[model samples]
Target: MSELLSVQGLTVTPANNPGKKLVNNVSFTLQSGKTTCIVGESGSGKSLTALSVMGLLATSLNRTSGSIQFQGNEITHLSNDALSRIRGKQIGMIFQEPMTSLNPVLTVGFQIGESLTVHLGLKGDALKAKIAALLEQVGIPPERANAYPDELSGGQRQRVMIAMSIACEPKMLIADEPTTALDVTVQAQILALLDELKTRMNMGMLFITHDFGVVADIADDVLVMFRGEVVEAGSVDEVLFKPQHPYTKALLDCVPDAEGKKQLKPIDYSWLEAA
Candidate 1:
């Protein structure tokens, strides 16, 4: 099957210096219904790469050179209006912080249904039914639909964000640390929910985070980014277990334990015996 999203020769620069780059020659393909993780420590520009695909870069920065093709259409030069149309309908996003992403003044239902209104032009009973169904799909009760963000727990708020992201059933979803602020169990649940949604919707996923544990639990493929470049990338096993990059090894060394232990043993080095 053809790639659902393809990024080529992607390079991004800070607005302050149009010539100086932050994301250099970054590129990857997202296949339908599979999870691709962008893993790296801080300053790796993983999040920025995802933003470039969504055309959600900061107003100041520019795509110096490269093409972002969504289902064969080059989106690099797409207008703001065109990008807006493609955003919620063709590409959905779940930010790291749900509280900040969602409107404090709006009811959860309103925020969840806003995409339906914008992307599907849904209203009245159709919108109502859709919103209710979306809440349920994301594992939230219909009663809580009318509740404000302040009234919900951190996990529940994240659910609302997921509901909003999957509202239009976009072909591709970008989850930027969807489990950042939640408890361990809640984080597991959210990852499971995203996993289920991806399978059910047949959606491609670009999951960005610094957490290797989360990536291990959910990623099909891993792209290890370092200093704005993809140092290593392949199947999860290749990148996680049999990694060839020193930066990748350094990252895996830092996946901490609940007891606040010194470091974690390498997954392959500890998990299995050599064949």
Candidate 2:
């Protein structure tokens, strides 16, 4: 697979507090048809890192330093207009909460068609046809396109979000805890759908999650972050089975075994103070 995205020396911090880093010198590469999972607890800079790549960092925060290259082109400093052109067309992002991310006032069909209309200039019958196809693609019935965000179940709302993200057939997809709100069965279904879509579209996926279960289910490569830094990075097997960083091992120990045989351990950060 070809390289789809390359992030080097990426850093983020509050605009007023440049000395304090929220994300420090983090780097990784994503290849087409592959999923790279960034696993960490809250405030570990996982979401901030993804937001920086999409040029969606909060106004109060600054990228500080980084180079984000997509399709061999630098995008870290692209203007708003330039980024807008690529945002929904070449790169799609599914935010953490579908209810918050999606506009409640609009119909789901309209929401899904927005990108098709703007980025692809699709309209009229062609637009309607495409929206229905996308809905079906994500396992939602085409008829449900008329439903509002609140009208759908948690899983359905997420499926709608997935449909919107893939509507324009972007080369890269960023999903930030897409399945966190769903039940176990639904979560598994969403994971499978995302994997299938990635393979079918040959799109590179950057999945952010705190769940080690999720990392095991979908990641081809893994990056373990703690306190805003990548403490370890490698293939899923290498990082999960042969962790070299203290933080990585601690995080893994917290995951309970399927048979309820292994004891769950709280994360130990004593090594941080020593380092």
Q: State the lDDT of candidate 2 residue by residue for 1-275, as single tens digits.
A: 55799999999999999999999999999999999999998889999999999999999999999899999999977899999999989998997789998899999999999999999899999999999999999998999889999999999999999999999999999999999999989999999999999999999999999988899999999999998999999999999999999999999998869974556677898988898
Candidate number achieving the greatest lDDT relative to the actual structure: 2
lDDT of each: 0.90, 0.93
Q: List the residue pairs that clash in candidate 1.
A: none
Model 1: lDDT of residue 118: 85
For candidate 1, which ten residues in a row score worst on lDDT? 266-275
lDDT of 1: 0.90
**Residue pairs whose backbone atoms clash in candidate 2:** none
Tally clashes: model 2.
Answer: 0
Residue 112, candidate 1: Cα error in Å is 0.9
Candidate 1 to truth, TM: 0.93
